[model samples]
Target: MSAFLRSCRRIFWALAAFSGMSNLLMLTGSFFMLQVYDRVLPGRSIPTLIALMALATVLYLFQGGLDLVRSRISGRVGRYLDEKLSIRVFDALVRMPLKTRADGDGLQPLRDLDQVRGFLSGGGPTALFDLPWMPIYLGVCFLFHFWIGVTALVGAVVLVGITMLTETRTRGPARASSRLAVSRSALAIEGRRNAEVLQAMGMRRQAALRWREVNVKYLAANERASDVANGLGGISKVFRSILQSLVLAVGAVLVINQESTAGIIIAGSILTARALAPVELAIANWKGFVAARQSGQRLDQLLKILPCEEERLALPAPGETLVVEHLYVGAPNAERPTLSEVSFALRRGQAVGIIGPSGSGKSTLARALVGVWPSVRGRIRLDNAALEHWASDALGRHIGYLPQDVELFEGSIAANIARFDVHATAAAVLEASRAAGAHDLILSLPDAYSTKIGEGGMTLSAGQRQRIGLARAFYGKPFLVVLDEPSSNLDSEGEEALTQAILNVRCRGGIVVVVAHRPKALEGVDHVLVLGDGRVQSFGKREEVLNRVLRNPVPLKVVAEGPGGGR
Candidate 1:
């Protein structure tokens, strides 16, 4: 993380230089007043006054320019931060373990990044930079009179104590509020995503009530933090006001004793105020500082977990060969494996059907095969190379997968079918659609391949969505294809199209694995792998395993065509 920040060191250095110049010029007002009272008024010299005013005008203009330049530099620093971390955060989110992903909102890291960026560009950090110059103002005050310097120094100490008190009282509540905000956001997003199911089941009120519970907690935490910060800020403001007036009183007393000039009294007050301004601003913006600090810590942790990029040798594109060696996989956070000690080897031009009851690990096997879920034991290799050994983007090009829960992005149908690749040609997309038997169906739509779909393709029927997903899996002519419950929503015509699609894949010498609960969908499969209770029950030629399972009466249910051709 420090290395990443060092990339923007040049801009930080520029900001520091500008801030120093600006702080130095900040004494112009006090100096101008000092010259007027001590020299021009006492000497009755209009010429001197005019010349002094002209010099002050140029200094003030230069001060304003430095201030503007620093602000622009700060903005550039914020952009640099986002540019460095956004892609890494996105990659971390994508590669996070499934259990971790489910336990918290994935979007929180992005929000944290935004918070950090906003703080760097805001006044909070600028106040911090100006804070180190407070002593410069206080030391100048000492030049006027010892009593005035003593008073200003005491006030600075008191304000610093108050700022510390504010942080001490508000830190816990601020952190609590940030955490609750993230959780509340996650619940609201989940509620929105599943709104249809809740509405149909008449559970919208219950869901809303549950979400309100978390929201109330979030609000209460925020209110507590705000009350503490505001209370401390008000106290700091009152102290600062009283301190400024006290400086004037002290200077007046010294002037009455004929020890200091009238110019000293006014200049002392202005310098005292300048010394305390940064401290007061810091107190007021303490909450934002705390939040940004917490966000930085979280982002640092996320960066630690993200895999580092290495210069890997580009391996050759894999053929239709998959080997699973004593593979074992479990669901995220599950104690027992979902698929245990399952091993199989598949070659080119072969179609395998995985049959089992619901929760029988068929879908789990499919996920493992496609590298969507990691195995707890053993390895999955393609063309003699372990799955993890291949670069992710390079390996992805050789695989196609259609999960049981079909989800589509909001875009034109052709874009989704082409995997949203900007370089994909229309001819390639149409060919994939044709292979999935969806080209004619797409043409029947009002806008054909140009039809716009909603989030998750909610505008299409379930069968239509499934067929489009199948077309997506068929895109790019991948070496291996895994489809889970592909026929669950398909009608007879759609099933026929699916069968033809599987045959076409085999003809092209690609490997196809289908996880199906319906026996009819397994027609023409060369091999069968039956699973039960996270263990492989049988694995052999399709007809041989089907015959043995049908001949023997086992606890594992076998769904095949019965003697009279009835399921």
Candidate 2:
């Protein structure tokens, strides 16, 4: 609220100044017109006539200048607020809990914010807060004659009421239309994202039909809302015309009775329009306010969500081992736990391979180890201390993770490799690349390490992308290295390279836990854990786990080779 107020202050002050100057100037002009009619024309001095003309011209010029300044400053203030709000919202999103982000519906905040830009740019009510003369003009009318002022004010209110009534009748349809439009927009985005797949499946026509259905639904609602709004606009126009006619009639009568000067009557007529302008606009843009209100509530809800300390990123610690004790974790409002009664410890320099079928909770365990699942009902410790005790930055430095689906930024190869450490020398990157078996491939490219990878490394083959991901894990010599499905999308050579990279991390006295499906990749690991249905089926030395697997042929084919070289 403080921020919002501060953002509005400049515009408010500018509006106040503009309103005051315009009113004073207009009043001065009214007095001048009266002097010209009642004094100048009746054999007044030439000097007096010149003086009145000069003063009126100066007042009009000053009014124009004040209005110009107000408009410019108000626009600048609105833009500044737009930038500030966008930055704050983005920062909040980055800090939001993973679960909350995933469960939330859409990117409507961004869209609504865009609409807010239009509203602000339209210089709506926010820009009129300082216009005190609007009321003062009416007060002047009342001072001249109470009944006249009362009639005008009442007419203004009734005009506004009629406009608002019409708007209200269509509000529901307007909101429904907005929702339908957003839905169609989301579908369009989804279709564009999967255009390749849709083409492959020959479903483009079907997709187009679905898109047409959504479009028709959205258009129908929009047309209904538009029709109702136009009707309300017509009503508002009639009321305004009636109000203006009454003001003119009253002003003419006053002029004839000599109760008010002709100049004052004319000024009063203009004031009538000025006074009702904001009311008319306020009624017309009630929907903008409604939308803003809804958007604010959503942002407030997101801000109000409690932080989950466990999943939050923490600083690295100079710890040797990571441990979990009977950890239990599940999504909010879920009846069954994703993982429960799971206990494990990773020692310094240990290599542990976790094997499981799809949906066996192996990936969840990996995520838990990285502190992404903070609501788990158990303890995770680093060097015998609570995981939360460590700072997020420090913790990240001590751990390197390669998710099953690789994520790469759109940048040159060197840029991605040096992301965590900007000062990483070429030699260090080359060494890491070699370990991951990507150095030769990178060198084969026209630009070598300087080669620009497309967004998410889309330009690279799947296997090459996986190698780059693996190479990033080796870039930093973290205490713990976690690789989930490192070889799932890799070919024979890529798998060989990934296995060697794992060996390299292990050789450096770093703990490695890899979720693997291939037998060759698990070779020579210090320990093996077989998981099924969120429970540990077996956990022991590599040889022991292999013996059990041999008894009952492993679910994933495990081709073995005596402790030797390549696959």
**Model 2: number of backbone collisions:** 9
lDDT of each: 0.85, 0.71
Give candidate 1 misplaced runs (Cα > 4 Å): 97-99, 558-567
Report the C-alpha lDDT of model 1 over 1-567, residue by residue, as the tens digit.
466667777777777788889999999999899989999999999999999999999999999999998888888788888888889888887777643544546777888889889988887778888899999999999988889989999999999999999989998998889889888988888888898899999999998898899999999999999999999899989998999899989988898999998898898899999999999999888888898888888888877866555656889988858898998998766787888899888898888988766677888888888887889999998899898887777878888898888899999999999999889998889989998989999999889999998887988998898889999999999989898888888878888888899989989989999887667678847888888888888888889988877776764555533211111
**Candidate 1, 264: how far from true, in Å?**
1.4
**True-vs-predicted CA distance for residue 375, candidate 1, Å:** 2.0
Q: Model 2, 362-474: lDDT tens per residue? A: 78787777766664588888788675676665677777787877878888887786554767888888877887888988888889988889876878887777778878877
Candidate 2 structure, TM-score to reference: 0.86
Locate the minimum summed-lDDT window of 10 residues in model 2: 558-567
Best by TM-score: 1
Please report how far candidate 2 places residue 15 from its true position, in Å. 5.4
